[model samples]
Target chain A: MFPGKYQAVHAAALTVVLLALAASGVQAFIFSDPGSLYTAAIPDSWIYQAYHSTDQLAVFYGEGDWDLLYFEGLGKVADQSVRELAERSLALYGEPGGLSGFQLETPLLPVEVGGLQGLACAYTYQDERGNLLWEYRIFLLLPDGEGFSIALGSNGPWVKNNPPVLEEVLKKWQWTD
Target chain B: MAVDRLRKLSAWVIVLLFFSVIAAPVQASAASSGKAGAARFERALGGGAVPEILKQYGGEYVLPLGQRLWVEEVFRRLVGAAERQDVEYTLTVLNSAELNAFALPGGYVFITRGLVNAIGRDEAKLAAVLGHEIAHIEEKHGMNAVLRQMGLTVLLEVGMLAVDFASADLLRLAGTTLLELISRGWGREAEFEADLVGQTLAVRAGFDGSGAVSLLDGVLNLDSEDLPMKVFRTHPDTQERRERLEANLASFWPPPAAVDDPQVLERLNGGRILAQAGRNDPRGRYIVSLQENGAGLHIFDLQLGESALWLEGASVRDFAWSPQGQYLAVTLDEVSGDAVWICDRWGHVKRQIDLGRRRASQLSWSPEGKQLALLISDSGSQGILVTYAEADALVPMAADLGVEYSTWLEDGLFIFTGDAWYCISPPPVVPVTVQNPVPQVLQRQRILSPTVIKEGSTIRLTRPSLTMP
Candidate 1:
């Protein structure tokens, strides 16, 4: 075989291998729940945990390691304001059965949830078994009195430094109902 | 020359990507079919081994001979009514306080003691729970996970839950522990089907189908707070299960006079304990610990050895069981600031009292189990406050904040503060706080803790052994 032909063949094979690796690793995705409870553009490489997911909860893990993202749909929080719900949620998260060592990273702010007016708060906690640093974002939807949260817990520092993948997720998230 | 090489590379990449999509081993969200359905499921994990492993997770409760006969008889009747008669079903009672019932392949149906206690004497409710498990086994839902990724990381947690669909899923869950899987749920569609079939079997077995409703109601009682919580996190989510079952069974809806006397079969099976608040309610079988590091309070069933309730926010500085072992007083470490929670037998927090800037310790219940006496240490001094666990404020024996002493008067129990000794029962001689008498009357029947006596302005008491501070 000619050296030029050999170089082209080698280049082609390498391209295919890299493409396969990318497909198995950081793949593009969309999640549509069977019950039509939710539809969202899942963050790249995030594996949706269907068994753990429920009508009220959608759990996703990213980074091929453990960058956890939880989309929890808390229905009809009565007459409480988003801020109040955020406080109660923090309290619940700080309760005995909830996350460990949940400390507020910052005061709650008004933000957008799937493009809705919502209350946003950031807190840090160790996992239930007193595991690694877990930072969580609570988004209480002002409309419908419903709320969802996006929490990112990690055992590695890479996830903390990377721009949150949830930015794309929330940008594409939509309520099917 | 470079452009020509890039074109060749691009052509190969596009062709490879096209084939990958077609050949990808990813499972579709839909229920699989054809050969996938017919494939041999769990050659080793399928049969009796699954139940034994489950029994290891949820330890077995060997019932008394007569009571065992009654439950077995109930199981036999339900088995008689079920459609799949080939599978010989066996019922194993689990010594767990969590309201749970699960079926393993090979007809092994397990029910927890919590369900038994919650159902009390209602054989029908027991039948409803047992029937659900039986339906799961008969439908083959219990054994239907085919091998996937045959060479992947197999997490046989306790040599349980390995190399199958659940374990296959486990490969992706880098963060999900077995506790999270169990705490969240198994699945929904299969669970809902089990409910329908289970209720049908129960009705066919001469038990009221509404027993499913009452049985779920008991779960609601334990899980009402929507605590995304540890308790009553059923396979299909409890509230939805009840609604779905109710909608499906709407024709005969609530069977007339279905308000069953749950106490009837209860007494026949040798007297189950009904929780009368403020006394030693025998409903508590799970023991709790602020496991060594003191950050999380894990409630472990004495018999099951499984941690059912995991309370994990701050260090549990102190904890004490009520005199009757019906309630627990837990003082959380001040990482969340000072507070004490009055929790039920199952360790679900019934009430949380914010202790301002001060901290509390030595959580012990007062005699007769009506009030909790905890030593509250403020910035200045530490003093004992006798608080009625039901109310937020301490029910002052008189007007002062501290319980100087406590005694059993002829009429009732009296606690002395700096001002006066107030009688707390046979109607309080000087009731300073609003008293709810029902539980107090029940507690008056017996001395649950060792003893307590009130002196002029001082009291000495001995608490139950497991008091933590």
Candidate 2:
């Protein structure tokens, strides 16, 4: 159980949200999928199954929420080119109702995780109505030459409220190669 | 004169009637605002009620449940995959914007809609959160808190009545919502421990172990500006956790690379849809009395509109349920006193357990329903866990963690929230002798005050002394 020490902090946080509202009325927001930042082409089926299997996944019921799974199959692609993949994915999936326009950050961070090369990026989108929807994207470049992208976007009125369940579908995506 | 009087009366009557009609609608509108103005509304206004405010703000929503059910089902499957016990677990939707999740003893896990909504978009991050909370339950965090708060005798006593002492402590706790407690935003060591366990679980389940880092990193970013301050203020400092995670990654997944499982997200989304249908109806019958938000035990029949099967008094803190559903055991103490009142399901005083001049800090019941445990301390430092029987016979089982609170999972396994746990076997079979523990060290450690314990047939308490320190 949380102790009495945290009341002030939460109370303050509440004030911040309220203040944000006063400055700008509550607005809807969403994200455009940042294109695939895959290092190389990987089979989508393996990516899909990793998302499908319930055994190893956890659907967090908190912020940083997502459906997570591991996959194998993608060979490494050039780091910069993977940004193109992310752009493509965003162009295909990021239609802008929950978000305005989506933009991506670079993806060269080396992450220690399952044997796949990890690509991390951030997305900024405006909802169709034009609110700020911020999404942080994580793409795992698998060992077998395939890659899967994990995008977290919010569609909530304040910012965006995209539920992490979207990862399940993205996980299933495979490469033609 | 008669005609003039009649005309005047007529005029007055017409004016009164006209005003009444005008006032009616205005009054109704004000009343609606008042209802929505309450604290609950504040909660709703945050993120819980986002659907209604999306257009007002600038957010998009996926119609028909928002994958809430998909997330639930996906988590459930993972729970099953992890072999979580088959017990009736009810989830309360906490209305907060912070990243938090916690499980109360007795299969009760409360996750905020904010958390649910957030998890729907990212599979790995979602996994990290679920795995962490599940680990808390798996590791018996609730039970441990009970062990650290109360002792065994009062635990068994309140068990029959569904009482909990931790409520006061939980209320006394610093945060406004339960999420803070689960996230251990206060830098709780137990929280860090849960995170560790969660990371291992994620890896064992074939997830990228670093998911925790991703999740934490994302959570840290929510504040936007206070990144450093927030990280330092919360449990396990985000950066340190990431570094530690990098070191531990090798032990679990070899090569430690990022892997993708798109299917996991698909199932989660599907599960979220189904779960949305099953979400609890806040308008149901078991309404809290208008006088109190939630003071004592709040129980509703499977069907709403039914009478509350049981309720406890305000000062009568924390309780545990009987495995057989026959009774509840509760602990009662003055806001700041040395006496602890043990009560039963019907709200009758069973007997008072005295902590020898010092007030009892907490009480707990073992899963077996036969034995009880008590944690008595004064001024925070001195504490001990006394294993006893509901029959008024007390016995000393183990010491350490200062026995602040205790809860039983089942049989010999019980978690003392202070430091470790005590696995009392065969019902303690003999009576316990009470002893006075030193009070200094007890005050420094964080302990669970109001606690609840629920255990099934298969749960085992193998360790005698499991210390957190």
Candidate 3:
């Protein structure tokens, strides 16, 4: 009787391990592309789409009013410091009264992405209909003199509701090249 | 036992149903929210006006019309004076302190307040700056530059797509090409051509053609450590350009006359304004002249000796000093017509070459100071006429509708034009029939800034030259 019990327990443990492996594989399949210049692990519930072209490569994920855009090879800036480039990147957002009232939520701070030094900041703005929106941005300088940027935006209330998910997404971002 | 198991399964099914009911609304709300966010983002990027976009990027400045009245007036006068009037021009004064001026498609010209203030009170210099931007518009140099950048075939294909579908990406590509042109600057040849056209337009509009030189001088005076300045980076070789301007001043316009009228002399002497001075004159005295309220040329010695009225009852457009500084070639704009006067150091008219009806331009004195080459134009027909101080006749050299610009070669053997250098052997005697000689092609490539320099017996040109047979 004890022998059979031991066998039963072993089989159950193997099944659980297999299920965990399948879940992780499904997540990787949905979120990551090894052939791309960069990849990120997105939440399973979000929709993912990739845009590829000679000039630009981008990945966009959306769920409800929360959206994230990861851009690689976004063109070049005149030889300038990465900090200045980050400031310029912030200017791409439409100003107040149209789509967003641009306000700095967090000052630019040093961060590391893909083992390369970069800058990260958070900003808040009002949408066209006066809804409070927030965005987190990361700017990285590539070795090839090109720049990479990431923008994660969502309604203020949604971001407040899902802090852990947002942090996980940010943590999972990786640069392949 | 079967009843107990069925009861447990029924309880589990109820729990699943309860969770689905709670989560369905949340998923639906998220989908709707995502759609809305996407729409908002697309609208934001796609619908903003260019001016607003430019503002967001700190690319423009808001200057009141009152503050820019003078600039606007000068710009309007230049636009009215230009030969091409197909497009109405709008001028904007950027708020930045950078010394830059540029033109956009649809006849929009932008000049920084720094450039304007730096130019200050010198209307003619302002005209030179504006005229350059206008020439870029008139010649469509910007478009040509973009075409060169994007390749003609590819640009044309994208242009078709832009027109047919109004595709934003194609339009954006075109816009990017234009921005690059502005940032990188037009080719050196294009820049030189614009300079020529600009000075011509300024002179035609009754502004001093030398203002271009002065403007460049001001640009060179700017702090170079400000490396972010677009003018310096985009415009290469400022020193070379200044040298070219000096050469052009000597080759094209007449030297400034020496003003001698008592009132004009008093004003100039009191203000210490030496309008024109010969470089390294042996006598240690300079020739100074001033226009008497835009009507007469009053030439005198800056040493305060005696004042003499050089030419009365006529407006002087330009004047130039001979290489030896003995004679002054004065171009007068008269009520009757334009005339070139050769005056001595004493402000006496030694000889007069009346260019009847045909406007006289680009008076160049030969190295020996014996022959003066005059470019004469009438009703769009242009020809070169060589004049001698000893003789009253004009020797016709080369006349063609295609002659855009001409300069006297150092040896006095040829006149260099944009396409070819025409060999003009002076007539053996005065009052001889005009001889047309075949032009020797010095440069097979298109010459942009064809500057002819005479170093001893060697003739050096700005562009590459072929062996002259």
Candidate 4:
């Protein structure tokens, strides 16, 4: 094809793509930790926070904790197998503290992420203020009693709708050594 | 003789008519006095007024067993400190959160839960409150209002003080009239006198004189919009009261050095971190856990002036340093479950206490650091469980109290069952019924054994053997 004809076709395609993107109303951006630990494409509409003065790599993506995605490097409080950790976590949440309205939505299930084995579960509960919250937690075991966890919290419908942000983050994760 | 008899009859008619005319207005005045009339009649009749007062004020609020004992203990101490030779004071904690503190002529003192919460765990401030009410009684500030309002003068003047003049209507009229008068508070002079006398009483009761000053400061610092104590309009002049108390304290021969800890403010600041100083530490090193990044529980040993991130990756709910500052017990909420892991200052896990099937809500250190008191609960059972700090020994200390609050008690630990204070340490070896003390200041203070409470909500604290004075 001639150069002028090719330019005409390309501009038309670009315009259609831009219009489709505008219509979708979903936007995401790549987030990389300042320490160059890892990076992931996260929803731009959700809040993304990183606590710099922390030993654990605690990061949050949510609306002021009410609805959000959270990631943390939970240091070893106990030396246990991945299955043992999963069981204990389930039990921990099932019991009462400030959470009086706690219920298990789904049993723990083994899953694989980033070439590592981990456990994931979904649950529903009311916080101290009695705001009904739905949460999905994933715990990944690391070497030397170290573990990594990611929590996603929102209303039940959003959580049950396969939380798009969690799927996107998992799909776009980029770890740097 | 007939003429003399006629003269005598006429004289008898005149005397009878004279007394009737004089008594009619006095009776009308007494009748129109309303609740004051009812209260006066009740007082003269010599039945209890506390029940009537409580009935009007939403009944009595039964604090947890352990807390009730603590209040009673405070009342007893205040009584002994004041050295009153007569007039037994009944301390009744009315079930209102209106920040009211008032006294009745019958040595009855009432304080609201709102005032108690405002005081926090400061017993000295609580004494300051009680002492103020005591002053109202001591100075007969409320009594003058009581007599004029309750029509006691009417009865006294007519010489009907011993008459059974109270009707059902009079009894119904007793509460709100007196309640309204007390809630409005005594006049300016009476309040100032109460403040001065109350401070002295609290100081004599072994509390630091600064408690009154601190309490006043707290009131002044309250949100200007909500302005807690100011709602009663009693201490609306918070700044003025503080200045007056401070000046009076300066006049004291030797001012008290009792200063309140400013840590509750820290606790109230979103509670993002758990920071606490050791009970018996001389160096005043505080251990704080930072949740930033879930990086780990960093033991910030501010004593060495070093911020150390010793532990990592554990979700910490709460933690307490041992008495000797030798051991730190941190409650962890982890995927492996909620557990209390005891660590040393050197970052070593000494003991991991996981109460299977039961959750440990609070951990308090013994003064000696030899043991730790854990407020543990399950779906059905709630109590204080004492465990050897470094040992694997777990002893059920008190199964009678724990509605999810706990604190330290001089040589032992006190746990709140939300409604009662239960002693957890020393295990109460001697169980004594000790005839329920209807201590003055607590006119309607009823010590109901958990078994006596028929309420399904409160019956859970069945400490059949738990008897505390």
Candidate 5:
């Protein structure tokens, strides 16, 4: 026997649950845009910034000291592996001024991302003012030899403090297709 | 309608089974791929038989349990510090009395017990040696050499087979090739690369960055006819490598100011010892030296003409006497983990600290004698920590100078050697000061050795007086 008061309560609970589900659906749709070729889990705390290029996206987080960069592009140079291309691109962008302090903390090692073989490296360098910064770069090779590179850069202290969160985000990264 | 529903149900079941069959294996393969590759590599290298084969050579020594643990701990720390978690390293000690260390593919590193004994149980030297071998593995020198010997088609086939790869014929060929490479060593370029890589790892692991240089010096001092003379053949041109390493070290971390005039110090040699403190006490002097067999430490009282055995049984790696001559800090070599003993002048152990399976080499007593400064290796977690040891507290100084040698100044400050001579105030506050304010010039002049001289109630440091431009 469903009392009138109980029936009203059940209907309200159902509506609330449906609304929550719809809200999450909307959030996922917004993050995984249909036009984008890749999708990754970004922490709710991060603020989405402008896309630098058609293939590159940047997001800022953590007291304005850290940012996550994503890039996907076809092979521009001939006869180079995804690892080489990624390293070359990183060296160009990471050390634009040909700085001397750039060091690879972790060499290019095998990694599995989005169920595909990938390569990853961690590097550290000092700015002109001598502030230590670290970056972890992971590159996933595509079937057509295109590559997707993800970079997480921040001060040393912040990266050390957020290992688990960073690992989770990398674990959830995937190709949209 | 019933027939149609049954057909739909059967199709759904078939599709579900297909997904399960495909997905389960893929997940399993992904989980076990790395382990399987490692296992295959191990099998190809003859598994446990590799150590036995190495023991066939005369003078091979099996490490005691404690020493084994110590070696493993050090290796683990080095690998972790290098951030190379992909390869699993297995360290083996040959019981032979040969000063040699080498690496094999599949994470196998071998160091002779004689080599450890020869280096006087110095941990930094050990780290440098281990780091060099590890660099060989990380850089894939052995594997690349083998692959070059064999064709690329074989490697491709081996790669394709993955976990189920090992072939007996291929293993035999690979094993023979590895042995040849080990005997002949990698190319000069590879060796140089290994030296740089090893130095980087050793420095990063909080070891004395000069460890590689020290090891090379020791090697150079060895008799040409020694059994370890094979090192010359395997590692060609030691003097050149040493020079390169010295240059690299200087660039990476500049040398501290010279503590003594090399010309003046070079003239006198006989009775003078490398005393850490009390260089100017004319009335009497204390000198610490290794026993004839390098088994223990001997403290000689020059004034009294008496010598006392400070520590015996284990090799004395390093030691320091307090400024006031009240206490002595001595480090003992072990296969497990080295121990640092705080003892009185009469050789009575007051406090013993176990460094848990890694090397604790450099020790410096605070000027006031209330605290002892220790250069402790942090493996990979932190570089080296300059720890202040008091009666019941072990406080780590916040300075990250990668201190190689440290001494406490009379003014309650500590001078540590890293890129240069930098002074830091004692904890609970550590403020750093560079001894020389001038920008370092890249000249290759021989540095003066630091000496403490006393003149009329004043302590004087007789270091090389450099004219700043």
Candidate 6:
């Protein structure tokens, strides 16, 4: 009868601690968030309306993160033609996301999209804002017309200060005609 | 304390050993998967397709040796002769000793110097060869071979991998073994069909179909000892067929009238025959231009546009662009003796490769730009396609196409259109194992038209209408 009091007390404490741990684990599992982004295409045209809040980019001809060939084919020429368009476009408008007053470097990778026809490009250009913006750009020539697209996102300490919401929303903007 | 430490270490070792045993099989499976993937890739690229590969060896550059100007003139004449038939062509003379000829993917025809020399100045024999090569193209033999090759490669790789041979080395070994097994899959029927088609074409183009018989006779006599083996290995039985051809002189339509023109004969003979060729030196990718006269040619480029230059006129025609763009020498042609010029994309002279007296005719460059092929031709014996470098001439690429008037599509690939037989190269030496088999063959579409524009990046040619009865 004297030993029974200590055993009962130990069992009660163990049960309380176990319940707390299980509850905490369940809460974490239910509320933790994962990161992802994607786009949906509409009918009758090759335009895509993105549906995410993070910086989004895509390649139509070549692969890798920094490809501009998908945008170039919108201009109508296929294959290495995208590279030429990208180079020429960069020369006309400077860099798409850097502060070097539009200084865009040519693509370093061999990624292409839409068969073996288009190449990709990645660059940095300065936006209207004096602040430097890093942008992912693409060059493509579609059956309809030539096109160039830019995705501007904040980089460095600035990105942590202001999230890429504007750039994320703009990813949906594309030429339909 | 020491004993306790020793026990702990032993326990750790046991755990490590257990993991190794458990993971080894999985790692092996992963390695096998990589190999399987590689094999599939190789097959897709047609890298291990031996007959196709052999047919392509040293076939990318134009031979810049011999009387290049005269050869060009001969080609121009052939173009004129083809005007009536409304067929456009691309020609290349290969530098090799084997008496062979072939048509390639797209409209490409190659002839070897050996065939040229053996046939001598016989215009009829040359016409026969041209007709046969053109017939192969008309029947789409090259395309068939390519399609079959690609399909076989995929099936073979997938089938082998399914059988658990998943190692990369296994895939490679399987590919090699399969290549040897699949060499020269074209059989007798295709050869006969090509022969018939060639004969018909000769008659349509105003040449005597008897030329076919004469050309065959020349080929038989030139390599009489090996004719049976060659015919048996690559074609169906020919004795009865030859007899039929010999006896049925009435069946072969005659040239409606006795209109004789040496220039027409020369054009047909010089341009169409002995034009099997290719390039060396890790030859770059080829861009082909098919003209109305049923004549076509492949030009190698560096960065495209005006910057591109034609690597023509070396007696050996041995240098070509590699993937990284290197050059090598392979064969020697007799016409390479004259001054040869490398033309820019605009056909302007860029550089010269000279061979004093020995004329070069057949030329090819490797796709990787690491090797070159040259064929030497003369009045003596037909020349051979030799592999070489700037100074060192290596072994012959193969003996199927000759070097006279030729062009290359890429390294290891060419069109040998010569002397009544349009043949692919590296000689797909079939062994005596398979039963009556339908060997794969190459075929292409023949466009008969006249080119009118030569400016810009495109050419417009008037399509010719065929009045088939």
Give the true-contact fraction for every prediction, in order.
0.00, 0.00, 0.00, 0.00, 0.00, 0.00
Worst 10 residues of 2 chain B by lDDT: B436-445
- What are the per-residue Cα lDDT tens digits for candidate 2 across B259-289? 1345533443334222122112233423222
Give the Cα error of residue A22 in candidate 4, in Å.
76
Give the number of the best model, judged by lDDT: 4
Regions more than 4 Å wrong, model 6: A1-177, B1-88, B145-185, B222-233, B247-249, B252-469
Output the TM-score of candidate 5: 0.37
Task: Answer with 2 or 3, whichever has the higher lDDT.
Answer: 3
Model 1: clashing residue pairs?
A: A96-B311, A96-B312, B121-B266, B280-B324, B406-B454
- Please report how far candidate 3 places residue A106 from its true position, in Å: 52
CAPRI-wise, candidate 1 is: incorrect
lDDT of 5 by residue, B233-321 (tens): 88869988877776665334332333344443343232223354532222346677767776777767675687777567767776776
Residue-by-residue lDDT tens digits, candidate 5, A1-177? 569889999999999999997665322212453346666666555545442233333343333433443333433243246676556645543442333366777777877776777777776766545666676767665676554565566666445333654665666767777
Docking outcome class, model 2: incorrect
User: Model-by-model lDDT, in order?
Assistant: 0.55, 0.42, 0.57, 0.60, 0.58, 0.40
**Candidate 5: deviation at residue B49, Å?**
7.0
Better of 1 and 4 by lDDT: 4
Segments in model 5 whose C-alpha atoms lie over 4 Å from true places: A1-177, B1-43, B46-52, B58-60, B64-72, B153-169, B251-469
How well does candidate 2 score on lDDT at residue B219?
A: 60
Model 3 stretches with alpha carbons more than 4 Å out:
A1-177, B1-67, B153-169, B221-223, B226-228, B246-469
Interface RMSD, candidates in the order listed:
20.9, 23.1, 26.6, 21.5, 22.7, 25.2
Error of 1 at B353 (Å): 35
- Model 4: per-residue Cα lDDT at residue B209: 59
**Per-residue lDDT for B223 in model 2?**
70
lDDT of 4: 0.60
Each prediction's DockQ against the real complex: 0.01, 0.02, 0.00, 0.01, 0.01, 0.01
